[model samples]
Target: MIESHNTKGLIFNVQYYSIHDGPGIRTTVFMKGCPLKCLWCQNPESQRLQREIFFELEKCTGCGICVQACSEGAIELFEGRSRTNRKKCSGTGRCAEVCPVEARKIMGRSVTAKEVFEEVARDALFYQRSGGGVTLSGGEPLAQPRFAVSVLKLCKDAGIHTTVDTCGYASWDTVQQVLSYADLVLYDFKHIDPAEHKRYTGVSNELILDNARKIYHELAIPMLARVPIIPTYNDSADNIKATTQFISSELGKNIKVHLLPYHRLGETKYERLEKMDLAVLIEPPAEEQMLALQEIVQSFGLEAVLGG
Candidate 1:
């Protein structure tokens, strides 16, 4: 039945030697389709629910191979150039199939739990040496909760240290299932204020906060709360204080809060995906801004650290 229905997780990449995700030298499996759309998202290509193809216009070399490969006549060539009619195209990856230069990328691919585990466990020697295993990152892994849980359990059963990097925008059931097997949970705490969060990330944070508290109390797992320090969204001195206060008092020592500076890598993805450019609205926060923010939050008698 599983093979008949083609049930599989859509993964973008399996990154090796990743140090920032969890403990030392981990393999990060980036699953696609996120529930939230934060403006400053570093991995915008992972947002869509379905597979997407990115065409690098500069690398095209005006090649018409993709135009000829389309069976639906979805691709068009004009003025010595190739263009995909967004309305006519289905994003079925025909264009990507013929682009030999790797300029065309199908953003997501369906892979079985066994396939993913094999790739992850290939780095078993590295994991054993460095105390790292696999970290499941977004889009949002819980968006495909069943697949995420299955992979986590397989890793844990194999005696591999497992970490789940999530936005915490999933249902309590989904969160609980994955947490049942995860060793460390890197939870993203975007914003505290619901209205502000909605304005920035296109989602409310009520459930996110509730889930975080549940993880602290019910799950009681070792977790690190990450706050992306976007200017005008959640970087105010007052907001950081409020966030750290709640994290320290309510969440306990099992959790620590780290604030990250906003970045612009997602802007190019915005252009590629024909989405709006949010980078123009704000700049990356200054170093002094980070120090001040850290000081204010640490003054709350918490062990707040930087650099993940």
Candidate 2:
């Protein structure tokens, strides 16, 4: 059902040598766009499907150069400073190119599967030495299903291990396409309750939970469940217990669960993207709390690992 093509995908960053996304040291291709609007998203720039301009007010020197460079008249001076009228911006990136201090930046760019493969292949030596490979991360890797499958196929064809770190919110067909090439799948679980999940992620967890079960029972892909232990969100002992129970009972497989501690690392990124409302000032779960949650999962006869 999966077919490989030369389709292009919108991506924000091609992170080289990431040890956290998957096993060993791997190159993480961060695709732009997501189905969820989690308030605590670390990469706010990846949330939008389209290319966006991030203007840093501190870096701007009140220069009108961007105004002159924008062909769509997207920029203008307001209250003695240049402000980008996003509605008028065409995303041509000319304003970013003309900026003197890099105050204006384009967040996403379109790239073909071949181009991505070539860039990631530069780390072949590292992948070979560390038992590492390529990982497709998001926004939701399956959000751009065609590009994700193509990239995964390319890596696997080259005899490299592949992993897909997804939020598990795509169609079964799309998920199957990614599974066709991925050696491992890193599935993200936010909340066990559907109402709570919709409140936090702005999407019902029905699709996500259903997809996870299908991946486990039908495809039987070697998968790891990753949970972001956020404070005041799903960090309650009751919630953790429910999660472990669901994993053990529903999936019916003894799979290891990775508990990711929520951190404030993505706070600044929201500010940079001018989406500070999405930034939540929450503290990372304490070490004691993380360990306690790990114990809960282990109590259910499963291995629980802290972090990726």
Candidate 3:
């Protein structure tokens, strides 16, 4: 949260009955904005601090509805999706206003906590039938610690299982507050090397590791460390060993470590934001390579989950 204010699930996306995020079927709330810019990010739309407009090039009929709706002339026709000059846009909610077909659209919307709980409550029966609840994911849920804590506490009050999928880059105090109401913490550790971590993700891992260590002192809840195995980034044999050794010695082997195979799911989102071109970036890791890495995790006496 760049600026903390009490908010509901900021960007709610109901992923019905999924077994992967956590125990049983779960609903994951996709929060927006992240401190890290991992090269293999799969949800690029959730990378901004505010609701941003993106062009659905395939859905556009060239109706020019967006152009007519732009109050600041921020949107204009381009090679494909409307060329959005985000530098000048005020986030006025105008360009996406008049688009009838949703060619011009926003990725996320702010929802009140009560309203969000109502949506989650819709699956209360499912949660009760099977031990599944809500999973708060990112961009980085801790980024909006206040609202996230509210929602997590609300879920705990309602007897809903709460899990936070975070990079663990926040302050230990905030992390402790959020974890107080969470039943599980899916912490992320991409690269352990501080220099290389900064080079790619734009942030050092020192704070992240510090928070994780401190949070583990009151480790009453279950936590799983998720590592996104990026080829040529943190996939080397030495990196895996260092990460596994650290987790084993610091967080303990009881805390599981999972391997998330990088994918191109959010490749199109980069084009929509016009942030930077990554088409020439490295490809996803091969399945065989993924299994090999999983074996390494097992070697460190930890169970390895293939993909998240």
Q: Pick the candidate with the highest lDDT.
A: 2
* Candidate 2 structure quality by residue, lDDT tens digits, 1-308: 44454778999998987999888889999999999998788888899788989878888888799899889988888776688776877678898899999998999989999899999889998999999999999898988888888888888888888999999997888887778788888989899999999999999999988998999988988889899998998999899898888889998557889999988888888767666666789989999999999999999999999998
TM-score for candidate 1: 0.92
Least accurate 10 contiguous residues by lDDT in model 1: 1-10
Looking at candidate 2, the ten consecutive residues that score lowest on lDDT are 1-10
Predicted candidate 1 versus true structure: per-residue lDDT over 174-289, tens digit per residue: 78887888999998988777898898889998999899899878888888888888887788987888788778887885466777888776667765665554434568899999
Off by over 4 Å in 2: 1-5
Model 1 clash number: 0
The top-ranked prediction according to TM-score is 2
Can you tell me which runs of candidate 1 are displaced by over 4 Å?
1-7, 276-281
Per-candidate TM-score against the hidden true structure: 0.92, 0.95, 0.92
Model 2 pairs in collision: none
Pairs that collide in candidate 1 are none
Report the error of model 2 at residue 144, Å.
0.7
